[model samples]
Target chain A: MNRIDKKEAKHLLKQMMQIRQFEDAIMDLMARNIAEGGSHLYAGEEACAVGAMAAIRPDDYITSTHRGHGHAIAKGGSLPELMAEILGKETGVCKGKGGSLHLADVSKGNLGANGIVGGSIGIAAGAGLSIQLRGTDQIVLCFFGDGATNTGLFHESLNMAGKWKLPVVFICENNLYGMSVSVERACAIKDLTKKAVPYNMPAECCNGMDVLAVKDMVTKYAAKARTGEGPALIVCDTYRYYGHSRSDPRVYRTKEEEKSWRDRDCIITFGRKMQEQNILTEKEVTDLEKEVTAELEAAIDFAIKSPDPKPEELYKDVYFESPSS
Target chain B: MREITYRQALNEALSEEMERDQRVFLMGEDIAVYGGAYGVTLNLMQKFGEERVRDTAISEAAIIGAGLGAAITGMRPVVEIMYIDFMGICLEQIGNQVAKIRYMFGGKTTVPLVIRTEGGAGRTLGAHHSQSLESWFLHVPGLKVVMPATPADAKGLLKSAIREDNPILFIEHKMLYNVKGPVPEGEYLLPIGKAEVKRPGKDATVIAYSRMLYFALEAAKRLAEEGIEVEVIDPRTLLPLDMETISESVRKTHRAIIVEEGTKTGGTGAEIGMQIIENCFDYLDAPVLRIAGADVPMPKSAVLEKLAIPDAERIYREIKTLVS
Candidate 1:
């Protein structure tokens, strides 16, 4: 049974709607060529980030992936700052230095989105080590794709985390595709969650399209990690409606395949479910949509008006104390 | 002041830093109970406990990645890589991650990490265990590389590397661990990126670091008896090469010879030679020379290994050819 109440479901629906609108605005920005580089969109995976992040504390650390805008927003990151960072503006979260793939809001406990595959897994373990040593209740959430499981670092990090009993939750947003390669061709194990069994770490598989199910599962597992149970791997079987990045046409997968995953869209399914259960009215849904659209528009306007970073600032932050200084 | 071995000096630095800051900790393979592969961190786990002194699995990439993660999130991690040759397995974490994180993050984050690993060949540990591959790290930007020579330098530079808010690769020579020198009792932090003149002379400048610095000093003494004054300079920090001190020494002698234990191709000697030509080209009276190891994998036999690397005799011979 889902632990979420009627009021909590409404809140989750609003947050999910917010992420959809934000990602849609990003697509518009990419179409106009205002956002450079390969921008990984997070349209279908909204419930995974929003659900998992909502269960953790604001101070708890999280290391994201290339498709990180949703995770950052769900972790209480500023919309204007994220948009500015994507647009490479001075007022961006990282002062325009990190750009899109490297977006980070450290003050809000987002360790930044990494460009490398399987890069942030070990970092999350390290952060958990810090919390354990300091004797704090803080937990760390590491979000990665199914592709990361193939790297040696993933095994190494999990082994260390299990041995030390570090307070970290390894959440694999198994979108089933590593770029153009499908999960069937990539991983030997059909059930990706079973990969964590070798490390003696507890593992689970949750319906990622159900926001309440994801939120309930993360809440229970995150509590276990906090109470000195060590690291746990939670696999959220989700999907991305768009291509791998801005450049990918996603020709590798068929229309039937994409439509099958699209039918279970978290936002549309959850919103209708709320109305059917009388948890929320149609009037309430319309109001939330209008409010979220305006919020996203304001964020876009703020980013567009922001100034570009100066060329001289390039050499400023390479090292904390450079040799010349 | 009290005299201590290079190994003891490193142990003292780790203990003092851990005592001073609760955030400071040590994590490596066999470091806690086994006292480290080289015993550089002997008795640390007993004093600091398992929480502060962590013993990790034999995973270099995990050690480096965890250290980076701990650093950016408020803790100060000093990881041990057992041997410098093992860096080949974990260079992606150091080069692509730690070295690029802060810069790629727009300087919003700082990785205050120190990786202490021993390198250089005198021991017949073969190619996998013995190597002077500091040059590989020197090629990377945003990384501070420090190769301390004597006991004092080992103690002081390590303390500095631990306190500094940057990722530093602290390379210790394998043979220098037992060598003793004067080291201050407590609280000493040597400034990085500064060169020290071990012996002042007039005819020529001998630039070296780590174990090579000792060879340069021995050669300088032998040359002094022969009425040839050779100045020996140890550029302790390599990445931020102390070009100012090096250029000043070059102007006085008008000649320079760099001695390094690594291969002649793309060694530290090559970098020093290029800098000498670029900055002190007008002051030069003769072409710059370098005494470096032969271009080959380290051999198992002691005789062949010695022939491959530079020694006191080779330094003396190289300086004789440059000044005579």
Candidate 2:
């Protein structure tokens, strides 16, 4: 689209690097038993989250998947609060209740991430409905994996959003595999964008490794959604550099295939582009990397120093205080 | 005070709430133009317009999820699931999402929504349509399960559920829709977890709610004729069971009999019986007895369905045996 200016390119590259650095810190903490439960890192699919999320305003809503750290960061999430949540500290965004999978920063218009696959599809449509009812021009950008297209909620939400002309953008990050199962084996159709045909919505696909391509595509669709043209679909052909979760060895894919995807790493490619365009100097790039690393390290220290919830806190936040019988 | 059918009382509550608050809206399948499958929401679409009175497709999960999302965004959405049997289709949204959103979000968001559905077996609607599944929602921690036995409660409690900040599973009985009772005129809100003693007595206590409350009250009258005066207590809300009122009654009567239309096994009655033993074990004069439907699917045949569910006769017999 030739729309990537110097400022936009720098922002996208910085956001992608921040996400990568944050996930790497989480991996290190998980190794040391500092963060409990699964961490679905968004290392390889950084461009999909940063580009798509950066296209929307702070008030525009976005529903995320289990692998949602990048989306949260791009949507203006607090580094300390997110790290604290993953570390199960009382100062977390969800007050230590929701770990990695259920991170939510409502103030940033993040409806929250879901542990269940495709669980947030219908919720995104609902947020769209709310915006429409409120007579706002804001659009909802719903993020999900390729595996979500196989769920009933995918079809139901798409049809409802289409019928109602709700202002929503359904962005599918087709990272090829859902856990160990490859998309080729699970899906009958090869092109994920074709699934949007039945819903009669505008559908497109882009090189997920290119931040400019993803941002341009999402921005175009999001504009249409804001103008009340109904929901649109954009499938980002990407791959996760890490395994689906911490426990996964990724035995399903060959090492050669993994190396091929890593060579096209979104962060490196975007950084190189920024440097070649004279948008950022090598020193600037190196300084941004150090900044992200230091930010992540400080967040980790804050999380470590934060106290665990008191025993009495177990009874709070339940809302329903039924008599203990 | 004015006498109205349970359906009219519920309609009044919805109408009054919608009128009082601009944030309150209604959404469900067949609720807008059709006035709901049970006619409880009749003429609402005309009053509220299509924007506020939304008629959804036959997508139960989406309806529930949308309502939950709307509620989180500061909208009071009252969703009707048509029948309790259809709750299975959307129970994931309720159990996994709606019930846990507030707590999982660390109480940052409030899901002020009500899921209203009718459940009971009287008409021959077959095994699927006719089933009382209130016990299913009682096991969920963050949900408030409410069942109104009288028109007054049906009106006041529905208003209260709409006003509550937590998600509520408001289970209305199909048989109680036509039951007439006096509802107060204006601004009546019943507390969510309070139990009311319908008829006070001393020999035994009959713990029941919704449609079964009527059967228990009738059985209490028959038991009175036989010199066994039974106290009838209606637990309006199940999740926050009014164990205090229940235990107080059990302490006075020293005997208890629970009546419900749901199956006997794993029924809420068993939970109440256990609570009675735990709290008032020293005051008990006899083992708590439960008169519940047989542990089987509701049959379509009239005769079989009648035998499958508990009735006034069954409650009377159970109370007589417990008091003896």
Candidate 3:
């Protein structure tokens, strides 16, 4: 854990900033009626995404959830295409058919983000099964929310991966709440790793606010997964700074709770830590923030200039036409 | 050509496809060591090994989602959901994930997977196991629905559904598994949406599929003796209903009767009948008559089950009246 070089920390910091700024811009666009939809923002949970993503190779697959922009960016998705996809432009990754909730970049090994709560859990298991069948060392990192842990698929997928020893690392981003339903109300235990115990899979919990802690935990399980040791679950203790979606006012949460989590913000803490450690200076952190904002602005401008899909595009892609058919 | 049971024909199709392509594999509950609940996948695991022939837990949603995941990743997975009635457990996986992945991905991926499950009530298996639910998949736009009535179709259409890039819901009837029919010797594939004229006649056209096709054919034979020739058409694929062959036969005969084993309310007959009105309304014969199961849950009682489903006599009587 102490071996994380200054360059590595900076790269992780940059990725986290990119995700934070992207969500910030999406909220701005929603306020302005430009990007016309609800977006599940990944603002406070930046360390969880950045750290887990840092442990895998570029070719390794990751199945994402509704709040997936952080995963997409951390997996090295192009900003212009992602922004255009959110804006529903033809130049987007899914040709504008998949808006913010359904972004996918197969070429980058992001299987896709799903709208269904536990939709991508089994998909991750399948991807891991594919990897094992193909005799490859690749692993599939599955991201799901706390509410999805209560679904049947979560248990099924874990048992499958545990029994078959499929190469998957299931990451549960237990952000304390699932659309106003507290994790305590939904799940029997506060520690989400308890769900993994029944499947005979190794389970661990990490401080999601700390990038190094998440990276270390994911790196440990990912190594075991790559070596054909089967799947493991890592429950990250994090919090969402914003409401679940655009329409939510978050009346279920208290202002004290919000301020408490915001006080330990990943970006602020990571930046200050690096500055104190001489990895980066105060001026350097400010410059990084300025660079992220400028890049986000350009992405917005590009999305605005991109062409909307034609009306005929509605009929396309309903079914894949094969040569034999 | 040699005669084989519908079950053997399906086994041949799966075996040939697994032999032909390295990427194709099979997964379901008890399909590997147990040879499936209905025995259609017998000896496949022994032939293909446990790697290709995967036996899953009683997890319907995971099986379907895994099939979709594998298919999107360039592997051909034929996922069996055991029975069509069990489709309700994983309908979200079917309707939300498996069917919609390719379209939602905007043609960037090709999902080639088949969900093979048996339907129809002949054995008194009660309400849950014996119901025919192929019509449920027909409503999902991104899915291709197929039900093969004959052994020849069982082999050919299964091959075609495996090769087709779209996600297909291949519904087989439990009653038709033992039905024998002649099959071709070598590898052959049938078009997914072509309807075959099983027995050609001119007085009235009968559009039927799966188990209902046999009843209609028997009724046609009885009607032929009564000087009323009933043309029987088997619409093997429901999603892409072969309207070309159906409408053509309707135009020729000027009368149409739809036969299905599913209950009457929201059955396949309603859609096919409405399409007949939409397409061949000007042909001017009569309103499309449908002989379908009674609109109620399949009862465990043998007599009640017999009374609920339409039989050869009911088809004969219905077609005779329509022709008159």
Candidate 4:
């Protein structure tokens, strides 16, 4: 095991805590009818996004899933833009056109999160192809749930990526459910990593609750892929604390089962480990929490106050026509 | 000037564009090895190799999804659907993703993609394969829909669509593929969204597109023997339609007849009829006439199929009523 320094560990812990607090606040806002529309919470999967994002450069691209707040935040997307997009404000990242499921920050190399299951896998492969064609050393990280692995698009994208030697890392966040259906029921083969073998790509499974473990494994794989060693698939055994969406009561899983994963909450595990190692003092952790709370509140306020898109602007930007024309 | 079939003209356009720009490539079902179902992409795989001229699986959504991704990332992709009816499997990707990407992204992206599909019901292919669905795309604002009726326009307009910085749905009539005409040999581009007057006359304006343009012209030739001079106009591109030219023709001719192979109810002709009434209603001598396919689905029987879609005889009948 490669040990990270105390400061690095503290910084990573702070980011994870920030993601947790932000998601919790979004849930609260949704309940209060402040954030309209359906929202998929990322409460229990912060470590997967934060750890994998920590391993990549800002210029390296990433395609995300609908449960994507953590991925967006870790990839350096502005909180104001994300919040505004959810609120359907004109100042949002996609200018109110793309809501929660379609958040994008191209400047930070974070491709948009897709509404369709397994939609972004092919997109990520194409992004990898773009990088290869441009002779750039950038790699694309594609994040999808275990449910998406069963999609034909997944196999198609994986096969193409393998054949083309595209530089991409396919990350599967196996929360063990595809919406209401269990992974066991949906997939014949439980282990998604094994599916990568037929494509001639390296595959690995990691402890999704352990941020450092995920970070270390991803760093190695990402470095290899960036150097043109081809694509890699990493299956992170994670869990979602809440149900699939805002409406799901989560009756599929037993209370004991939910509690078991909750006990290994990524944010709690990382914070406790950092405290035990004396990396972050209690006051520093509290200050970080307070800072994130204030930031989330400010973002919510900005989004609520922003005006809606003008009706006349609907026809604009449909194409990249010349301005003079 | 050079003489070539519409199919060869389209093939030459694809070949020339691919050679000129490395980012331009072609992908479709059986487009590579089989040279396209209509033979519009023949011998391209041999010239550009498999990497550029790709043959994808039978997944329509995946084929178009790959095209969307490639287009946004700086590649100009020309994707061919075996038939327009297959767009049902990939409409969300084309209508929602490819069409709205640039606008939804605040102009931060560009989908320079062209989806080439053949429509029209002369092949006796039945309801599943044959249908003219241009109105479905024209109803969407983000897409630019073009239908070239002649060999020369097929080559020039396709080249323009390839060079365009937006998503264009280039609809070709299956019946027009074998038709031969004079095409310029060198690099030439026809302006999109512009209508052309094929035969100028004074009595009535016959507006049409795709295979319907041939019928309209034939009807006009037949009407000329009866002392009815008809102006035949083809609104080559439907979405950004040249309303000015069409309205001007209507103003000169006084009478108007909109002809299309698609169903008359809610068809592209209906939209054109509405535009004429809105813009040039006062200049009209009579209510604009619409000659189109029957409201029912295209039939498999040869005689019934003939009755379903508009032809020269039907167009001539409609023109006679309007002129009388």
Model 2 iRMS (Å) reads 4.4
Candidate 3 structure quality by residue, lDDT tens digits, A60-130? 99999999999999999888899999999998888999888888988889999999999999889988888
Q: Judged by lDDT, which candidate is best?
A: 3
DockQ metric, candidate 2: 0.52
DockQ score of the complex predicted as candidate 3:
0.73
| Regions of candidate 4 where Cα sits further than 4 Å from its true position | A185-189, A194-202, A323-325, B295-299
Residue B51 of model 3 has an lDDT of 97
What's model 2's overall lDDT? 0.89
- Top-TM-score structure, candidate number: 3
Candidate 2 C-alpha lDDT tens digits along A125-232: 888888888888988999999999998888888988888888889999999999989999999999999998988899999999888889889999999999988999
lDDT of every model, 2 decimals = 0.90, 0.89, 0.91, 0.87
Residues A1-325 of candidate 1: C-alpha lDDT, one tens digit per residue: 5545667776788788888888888888889988776688889999999899879999999999988889988998788988998898998888888877888877789987888888888888899998888788999999999999999889999999988888989999999899999888999987988888888899999999888788888999899999999889999999998899878889889999889999999999988888887888898888888988888889899999999999998887778964211
Candidate 1, residues B32-65, lDDT tens digits: the string is 9999998998999999998888899999999999
All DockQ scores? 0.58, 0.52, 0.73, 0.44
DockQ of 4: 0.44
The TM-score of candidate 3's chain A against the true chain A comes to: 0.98
List the pairs of residues colliding in candidate 3: none
Q: Tell me the TM-score of each prediction against the true structure.
A: 0.97, 0.98, 0.98, 0.92
Runs in model 3 deviating more than 4 A are none
lDDT of 2 by residue, B1-324 (tens): 679999999999999999999888998999999999889889999998998999888888888888887887768889999999999988888998889987777778777889999999998998899999998887898899999999999998999999898899999999889999999988998899899999999998889999999988988898899888888999999988999999999999899888889999999888999999999999989888888989999999999999999889888887786677
